[model samples]
Target chain A: MDFRINDEQRQMRETAQEFFEDREVLERARERIDGEDVVDDLWDDLSEMDYPALTVPLEHGGLGDDVLYLSLLLEEAGRVALPAPLPETLAFGAFVLDELGSDAQKEQFLPAIADGDQRLSFALYESGQESLPRDIQLAATPTDDGYRLDGTKTLVPFGEQVDTIVVAARTGSGTGMDGVSLFLVDAERVDSEPQDTLDRTRPAAKLHFDDFEIGENALLGTEGEAGPTLQKAMDRYTVATCAMTVGAASRAVEMSSDYGSQREQFDKPIGQFQAVKHRIADMWMATQAARSLTYYAAWALENDEPDAARAVSEAKLFCSEQLTQVFADDIHNHGGMGFTSEHDGHIYFKQAKAWETFLGTPTEHLDRIADSHEL
Target chain B: MDFEYTEDQERFRQELREWLRENLPDGWQAGERPGTDDPEENVEFLLDWQRTLNDGGWAGLHWPEEYGGADASLLEQVIYNQETARVDAPARINAVGIDFVGPTLMELGTDEQKERFLPKIISGEELWCQGYSEPDAGSDLASLSLSAERNGDEFLLNGQKVWTSYAHVADWCFLLTRTDDSGPKHHGITVFLVDMDQEGIQTEPIHQITDETDFNEVFFDDAVAREEHIVGEIDEGWEVAMTLSAFEHSMSDVFSIEQRWRSLVEFCQEHERDGTPLAEHTHVRRELARLHTRIQAGKLTHYRNVSKQMETGVPGPEGSMDKVFNNQTEKKLENFARRLLGANNALWTDGPDDGQWVTDLLMPYGKMIAGGTKDVQRNIIAERVLGLPKDD
Candidate 1:
């Protein structure tokens, strides 16, 4: 019944923290937000540390670590608002491939992904759609050699840069979850345009697949059977996002605390004021709770627990809603400085806003949970 | 970071479950109030239930073996709490004695004191109430004016203690009194193991919003407290009081919250709204799911606190965090239950589940105020946990 992370997990987290700090990842994130090309080098540095390979199986030329390891590393990434496709690649890309990809598909892409030579993104949600299987409207018509993809995938993270995109499209006549299938499509085959998102640190794109042709070998798992696989992948992604929120929100609270201690108005540290102090305290409490739920969800997923799906939804719901409040309170605590662009507070604030609605909003996850419990 | 129980712990849980199944009152339903609706009868029933638990060796789980306890591990204690909550078992009648007074005594009591008081506390022979808060010194406990003037081998106690839960039925009290006033308010205080059955002691029950008299105002006029009964050093009982308060706040209430949530979910499932299952309503489902997530997060927070305590051998400020979270979460759940019940929420005996939901809604108000108000807990977290400066 121990809830403490093992020594290895702790060490990995510490190393990642140190690496992120030494690299000045937050400063680079700001530069990226200002339209600088910092992601490539940052991605390379992360690759050098083999972070992208953390979740890839050893048989697939990687560390074979579980989702907990990825969550720990992503938490560090989130602290600095790392502007990379790490979550898309490791959390969604590698996980889905390993879980449902064929031996041939795993042999083809897993090693490239592990080595950081290839980038991957997921195109799950279409226009005005949440991450529900029933919301998918992309079509994959059968062809002589393969399938022709047609539809648009909105909010595809790193869509313009990733080498491959895992597309969830309808392949059969069934509705909702029955007819959905995953296809590993070449990024060049799709028309991708980067969209201006609230979280500029992590760029997203709108992908247009106009009769994009792919061979039979591009199919991931069995056709018309990607419903459960995609759902599981989305849950994993949601948990990973929760881990990131814990990091970003904790950092925001720390910053606000420091600011309150130093920035004074009444001939004393503002932190001494109960109004400010209590707000920060509340933020800290929420952040701690979010972290606990996130870690538990990651553990449940890694261990294949029976309540894994429910746990993931719970974590996502709490992290998304509570962290947004934490960030808002943090900005309020900082007063005018928090409103300035020069301050890093707004960066986390925007990140929280983006995350609050990404993958699934709090309301959406609540519905998912209610459905799972048959309530 | 594992949440799975060990084989031995699982076996312990199974044994406790079996014992409960075989021993609980026949036709007992989970969360059902035991005995009659009469408050005094309810107390008696609870006392008997505690005795039954003690006879089965299920009382005082965290106390040392020599003190008539199992000397259980922290996780086992958590399991004990969780499993008991699962069955909605009757709360121990001697909670104040076991949770606050007994631990404080074990830490600060003299050998004679421990030997004389600890066993009875565990066996429910001597129910205890804490005497820290006065009418004027509720949150500012150090400002209490209950004086204990020295008179030979005993101290003559005077003044009053307010909001002393279980005082009306308590056999003894762990009291704090100002022994000297020549120094600061926090100084010159002393903690005494005072017998409540003596003369010159009067208890007036305070009616609560829930229509229950679970606490009282205890007045002491020339009440006697033996000099040898002092639990700690004279003029330094503030720290002792703080220790007792910490024990009060360190408990995890997530299990009970989860229990209430499970029952509410069942209600939602079985009940109907306009010819449809209440659970099928979008708003009801969303609210239920939201509350369920908070409860799950609260439980994890508690486990994290226990894990931290196990590693450091000392509870941290996270206890206050859990305290605030639990209170707020329960308050929210009870509020939601009331809303769900609608007009039936106002009904007493004629309402759903005999109007238990109304009681549930009204009960958590005192909890939020007791054991340190949620605001006071926020102050603790701000100062101790966040390292924020104290307010001027």
Candidate 2:
């Protein structure tokens, strides 16, 4: 069994690397963190590169069902800490639409998403609740002509800027993975309040759906049957986050390695010391493990392997835990400069922490894995 | 990227599995094979098992066909390792011979040496052990003081080698000898293929923490290593030794780790505390799940190593990463098994699972020391992979 990426995937990854590198995305990310509106153009540039369409099906005016390919692009985006909702747009938005969207819904959204004419965001988690089907408290009451959504979706990626928000709300009377439904809502009709997220590069918002009425055509999939579909979508999003964590952790290792080689205290590079050297080595090992698990999870999900859910949870758990440690080690290696907001090291550190808490924390994923295995 | 084996590889795995199923001695069981308690019987049984594997064309599966192997691809070798572990097949007795010495010979041995040694090594006819570490040169192997002075047609070997595994039963040794002191510590050393069944060589078994005698302290006095037995040049043994060590580090142990993890899971599933299975406890489930994820990640890391080796045609520093990861993960897993077993972890022969968890827990310490210490592996990754400045 070959583990190396194929030539096409290699080419796509290389192209993404060149694009992200040439765009000076990291510098722009720092600027955005400093309150400059420098990310919109970069997002548009990514759209021009057709990254949002990378995971859509061929029949939907996009590449095809390739989560692995989309993950590669997300990894590149994560490497530079690109300030955008690329994961939300592609891994969650386009992916869910392709998987469970009706023909009318696909026709209305997929092509525009592929054409980079429309941006999408997902609203899954609610305040003080986990991202589980039964945990969703958002109510989608049946109306005469449609349903009215009347709850808040916290931590919605790109919640304020995206054109459409896919919301997971309770539609039936059942609980615990039953009665959950997906709806496509116009972003303008919802009240969005951007939160002061730790990862400014990928901002989040709290979307308030106060009796937000939508027509029956707005239903993403069959009502009360969206549990598995939403779970799969969340799994895709989790794997995307993992891939990004690999990239960001890798970049952190590189940055720390460079800093260790150049920064000296005892008339030599500090890296010559076993303390620093071994720490970096461990960080490197952790990053490599994260990459391997992320890629395997992505492949498992794409192929619909029997263990896909468990693999996804495993990847999320390992990557989230390891990325945080890698970044902490990195920051420790950089000394004082690593702690400053001005230095690029803190960017990765913050992003690692943010990603660790995103989708699911390490403990949450561990529970998911345990439950999946019926332990 | 693909994780699925091709049909041919699957067939290779199935063939080996079928061979093992039909060939293993009657009443064979994992961890309770022919000789579980007696070292001598265990060695004999392992030798017989290796011969059986050789007869089945599975020994040294990755070796070239010219050398009596199947000429299996790297993936096939991985499959061999995994399937063997899955069935809990007896480990090959001549590991040093097949995994290290033969490969090193293929790379650096003369045609005569290959013709003479390769077949016996693969067949387990002449068991081999590596003689590299010395009393004072464990991590700093290049500083070993094992001297081998050249004479008329042979080298007179006089040195003490420590931590030599299976030396008591080995018929031959691939020795690292310091032939000169004129240059740096890493220079003027030589590798010699020395016969161990001679008066000049003696082995004293070292009882380990596991209460096993798998390790030994070997002393040599005027041991005869002919000039033709030298691998590569006389003073260039460092490169040859590094090659063997790379092979050692690159050997996949993830299958065994996975095996132990499965055993632990079974233990948790069957045993209970206060009317509930251990697996039902949230703490136990979390820990098992965590270890399970780490094991899967370790397996993937090994695949990445295999892929890298396939591309480069040689094991690189990435192998050290696998070694370090597996060593740590395996140690943690075994320790967790003990913790899960509680006081029952102390019982041997009569305890739960016949005290396998206890032995498994004590086993990883040697692994952490063998091939290379985990710290030395980190140093390799730091220096070779990360290009960090070496400590003065």
Candidate 3:
């Protein structure tokens, strides 16, 4: 078995990493820490590079790379703390549409997304979820033409001002998971107010769907059967976010190592002190572990491994917990500058904390794993 | 990028699996290997098992073919390790001879040394221990005072080595001796192949916290090592010693870690707290999940190390990463299990499966110390891997 990435993946990683580095995505991220503002140039550059089409099938006017490829791009974005819903609009959104969308839906949407004319947002959370497959309180009552959606989806990332919104809602009757359906709605049909999220670098919103009407074509996949499809979509999202978190943590580790080598209080570099050196070493170790698990999870999901969902949850739990610690220790390594508002360290720190809570916390994923693996 | 083994490797894995199925001594299960309670019986059982492996041409698979090995490719060696660890086959009692002494001999030993020593190592007729660490040279190994003076056709060896695993049972030792005191400490050392049966050699078993005496303090009072037994040139022992230690650092039995973790998960599922399965508890679930994730990551890291080794033709600092991370994870897992067991943790030999958890819990401290201390590993990462400034 080989753990090394193939030449194609290596090229993809280099391209993505170089784009972020040359664009100074870190500075751009720093400029919009207080709010979510998509830098037009950065988005255009990504679009020009066909990043949004990363998950689309080659037959459908896009790059045909799998979840592993998308994960690399997201990780690069995460390393620079790029304040965008690339994972939402590109990785997760494109995946759901490609797998579950009809020909009409794909025809109507996929090209604009590929060309950067449209951005897709996902509305999956209703209120706050203590567990996954949470009771979908959002109701999608069938109408003569299509369906009318009512209820709110909290934590709808990039919820405001998106071209299309794919939402998870209960259609027919039963409680959990069953009768759950995914619908693509025009962004203008719903009301979205930006929420003061923990990481303003990537803003989230509370979406209010009050009699939001959608056409018959909006229904993604089979109505009640959308549960498994949605679960798969969420798994992809979890792995993508985990890959990003891994990137962010490694960046934190890199910055901390640099700081440790340069910063000194005594006769020697502070890195020479065991306490400082070991703590940074610990962060580095955790970051490597997170990266390995994330890559494995991506591989498993792409290859349809038997334990795919378990692997996804494992990556989510590991990367979330590890990135949080790495970011925290990174701040400690930076001393006073890390505590200040101006330093890029806090941006990574906040993004890490945000990502930890973003799909699910480590504790939540742990519970999910317990159920899945029957631990 | 592929995680699955090649077809040939898979076939080899199946072959080994079938061989193990037919040949493994009865009552052996993954994660249920016997300890050092009955050293002689354990030795006998292990030697017999090693002979079986040798008979099957599976012994020392990584060694060159001329030295009584299969001369398997790196992938085959990895698959062999993975499969053997999966079956919990009795660990080869001659592991020190095979993994450490034999490899060093292949690199630096005279042709006669290889012919004399390599066959017995694979045949399980001889066992070896490493004699690098002294009582005062635990982390600062170069400061070791174990001295040997050159004599005609021999070296008169004298001094002490501590924490030498299997020394009490080993038939020979790859020893580090300070041959000259005039120059730099690291410059004056030599490595010798010392016969354990010789006079003027004494071994005092050191009972570890596990209540086992696999480790010992070996004293050499004018012990004789023939000139032909010296590995590499004299005054270059430091480099020779580093070779074996590097192997030890990278070669963790990670599949066994996976097996133990699976058993722990089963334990968490079978036992309950507050009328719910212990795994159902959020805190317990979190701990178990953490353990599971690290084990998975450690397993993959081993693969990454192997991949890096294949590319570089030598193991890199990445092995130290595996060594540090795996040891730390084991320590955390053991501590977590101990707490989860609570009062039951004290039931050594009275608990489940004859107190295996108790032993497993106490066993990782040695791992942290062996190869090199965790601090030394961190130093290696800092200095060698990360290119950080070294201490004055």
Instruction: Score each candidate by Cα lDDT.
Output: 0.87, 0.86, 0.81
Name the TM-score of candidate 1. 0.97
**TM-score to true structure, per model:** 0.97, 0.97, 0.95
In Å, residue A26's CA in model 3 sits off its true spot by 1.4
Cα lDDT of model 1 by residue, A1-375, tens digit: 888988999999899999999999999989889878786788799889998888999999999998887888888888999888888898899988998888999998999988988789998878745557777878899999999998888888888878899999999875688999999988987888988889888888899888788999999888988998898888888888888888998899889888888888879999988889889998998998898889999999989898898899899889878888998888898788778998787888888788787777788889988987888
Name the candidate, 2 or 3, with the larger TM-score value.
2
What are the per-model DockQ values?
0.84, 0.84, 0.63
Error of 2 at A64 (Å): 2.1
- Tens digits of per-residue lDDT, candidate 2, B1-392, equal 88888898889888888888899888775445667778999999999989988998888787889899888888878888898888778777898898889989998999999999999999999999999899899899899999999899888999899999999999999999999988999999899999999999999999988678999999999888999999999999998997775552246788999988888788899989989999998899999899989989999989988887888777888888888898889998988877886786667777765655567777788788787898899999988888888888
Model 1, span B1-392: residue lDDT tens: 88999999999999989998887866676546665479999999888888888899888888888898888888888888888888888878799898888989988889999989999988988899889899899878788899999999999999999999899999999898999989989999999989999888999999977777888999999999999999889999999987765542236889999999989888888889999988899999999999999999899989988888888777888888888888889999988988888777767768776766667777778778887888889999988877888877
Q: Write one digit per residue (lDDT tens) for candidate 3, span A1-375.
A: 888877888888888899888878888777666453655566787887888777777777877788887888788888888766688876678888888889988887887777787788888888676454656768999999998999988888778747788888888786777898899988776788888877777777788878788888999998866888778888888888888888888788788888888988876788888898888878888888888888899899999999898788888888777778888898898899989886677877777777777667777777777777665
Greater TM-score among 1 and 3 belongs to: 1
Checking candidate 1 for backbone clashes, the offending pairs are none
Docking class of 3: medium
Candidate 1: list runs displaced more than 4 Å.
Answer: B30-36, B245-250
Leading candidate by lDDT: 1
